[model samples]
Target: MPSLRNYDLFISHAWKYNEEYYALENLLSSADMFKYRNYSVPIHDPVIDPNTKVGQEKLADLIEAQIRPVQCVLVIAGMYAAHRFWIDKEVAIAQSYNKPIIGVIPKGQLRVPESVKFAAHEMVRWNTDSIISAIRSRAL
Candidate 1:
């Protein structure tokens, strides 16, 4: 059964959605008594081209707008190394808005980057229980 409390969350990603992202989605969906709405920007539905300065600003604005209403941000620590540019911007936006960030260490990952750790309010494992617990605790 889904919980009555539905959390709004922004999961950070590069332009392309990866396996980790899908895995996280599945984990959340299958978790007992957990419900959430994802505010992630999908590649199939991009806001704008981030190449130009104007477009970058617009995209940043869009990302900020997505993060503003969310209870917390979920960052895939393994994806950060490859997409630091946009992920960094997302983290900055979340921080500026006082949104809590939950850094999710990817399944089988042993080392998470220091940057991700530093930005996160709480670090959680890939397990659904741990992740849900962190979200419930930190978002408060």
Candidate 2:
């Protein structure tokens, strides 16, 4: 088989770590022949405080920087309801840069937010094969 391409990706979340986020990370890392570079801001290493207007702008800039070079943006659909603001900003950033957005519905999740549903270029399941396929076919 040919060597797999290494994709640059941005996984959107509420500026915090969650099970879905970690699961996807592990999945991608362990998948056979799949490789990726995650640009998502880790919870343990924050870029800025987002309490004030200036801070928010800085945060936005930081997020943009993370998204600018990415080929695709992976969104945790189940986390949208709770982190709509950040996720929306991430989506907007991804759109501005023409990065493909792939919404991953968490395992066993019943309902997904419309915000994510509408923004995603493609919605995928919380599985290694599905997510890898999306990145391979959809990522710019």
TM-score leader: 2
The residue ranges of model 2 lying beyond 4 angstroms of the native Cα positions read 44-47
Q: For model 1, name the residue pairs that clash.
A: none
How does each model score on TM-score? 0.89, 0.91
lDDT of 1 by residue, 1-140 (tens): 54378999998877554778888888998987888999986564454778879888988888998999999999989945444788889999999999999999998889997878999999998988899999988874
> Residue-wise lDDT of candidate 2 within 1-140, one digit each (tens)?
77778899998877454767888888889998888999986574454667778878988888999999999999989855455687788898899888999999998898889888998999998888899999999988
Checking candidate 2 for backbone clashes, the offending pairs are: none
User: What's the CA error at residue 66 for candidate 2, in Å?
Assistant: 0.5
Once model 2 is optimally superposed onto the true structure by TM-score, how far is the C-alpha of residue 2 displaced, in angstroms?
3.6
lDDT of 2: 0.85
Q: How many backbone clashes does candidate 2 have?
A: 0
Q: Relative to the unseen true structure, what is the C-alpha lDDT of residue 11 in candidate 1, on a scale of 0 to 100?
A: 88
- Please state the error at residue 68 of candidate 2 in Å: 0.5
